[model samples]
Target: MPSLVTPVLPSGRLNASAQPALPIDGDLLLRPWLASDAAAVARVFEDPTIQHWHLRKADSEDEARAWIEQWRRGWESETACHWAVADVGDDRVLGRVSLQSIIMVGGQAEISYWTTPESRGKGVCSRAVARVARWALEEVGFHRLELGHSTANVASCRIAEKTGFALEGIRRRALLHTDGWHDMYLHARLHEV
Candidate 1:
């Protein structure tokens, strides 16, 4: 019989300091979310797509600020990390990318993201996702990164594929949306040694 063992974190573990601003091409930058970005973040949540997929709604700037605060806590606790995807020229926030459900001992985490309505169809999410995945696998030393999206979300499917995540199959009734139970498509990318 073979013994099953999980990978453990190295000496100091992952860094939870200031989130790095990852540049994607010349148009997009993934930087840490700011307290001043509350208004913009609130606006992004106004889109029906984001509201539907994410379930909860941030109707006010205060709610959005709380969301940012939560992400900051996640970083400080070394449990998750999030970045705001911004336009390089003007520094306008375009979207968000987060590495959630982190398990340092297992060398794995789940990725989630959403783009403002204006930023859609511009490859912002795809580029940001790819950049973050690279950082997670190489710099952070995570062996695997997972992403899940509602089966009906074609855009998410395209983004996952563009970022090199292989389709791992579906989880029936995995999520509950306002409409009802929805199936989710699971995808993952593994770091090659």
Candidate 2:
């Protein structure tokens, strides 16, 4: 079937090249997940805050390694982009920031993230998110980037606002967690060209 409108971004636009490591600052950067970081990944999921908000866990090193592999494949599929926000000096994993639910035709993607307990309240997640948003909208040619969080996740709401993702509206009971359904706050940032 022929469509009137063309794809907003060309096929292979992302997978055509190696995924780039985006720099956040002198101390931090966004890099591909490594197999060696499995322990850190597993430990991060053990944090009560992370498990509660993310609603998933890597109970063992093997599970975390599998997740890392899956994230690598996601870059090839172009369906998702996941990065480990790490310290530049020691290369320690601090958190994760991702572009999920990507749609190439309309040039849109959803952003999601979680910071390690030790890194929380240090502005790490927000800064990493802001950097990723710039790369998505400016460097990658995405027209729109969205960040959605459960209404109860107030810290996530702050990250969205700090990254220039405007509060669009609330998605009633959009996400299910252990507690129950949650109303999600939808926020978006548009390419400024």
Question: TM-scores of the models, in the given order?
Answer: 0.93, 0.98
Q: Write candidate 2's Cα lDDT for 30-128 as tens digits.
A: 998899989999998998888788878887999999999999999999999999999999999999999989999999999999988999999999999
Q: Estimate candidate 2's alpha-carbon lDDT, on a 0 to 1 scale.
A: 0.92
Which residue pairs collide in model 2, if any? none
RMSD after CA superposition, every candidate = 2.7, 0.9
List lDDT for all candidates, in order. 0.89, 0.92
Off by over 4 Å in 2: none
Tens-place lDDT digits, model 1, residues 1-193: 5437655544246563566778888888898889999999888888888888998888899999999999988877778889999999999999999999898778889999999998899888898999999999987789899999999999999999999999999999999999999999999999889
lDDT of 1 at 39: 97
Q: Which stretches of candidate 1 lie over 4 Å from their true place?
A: 1-7
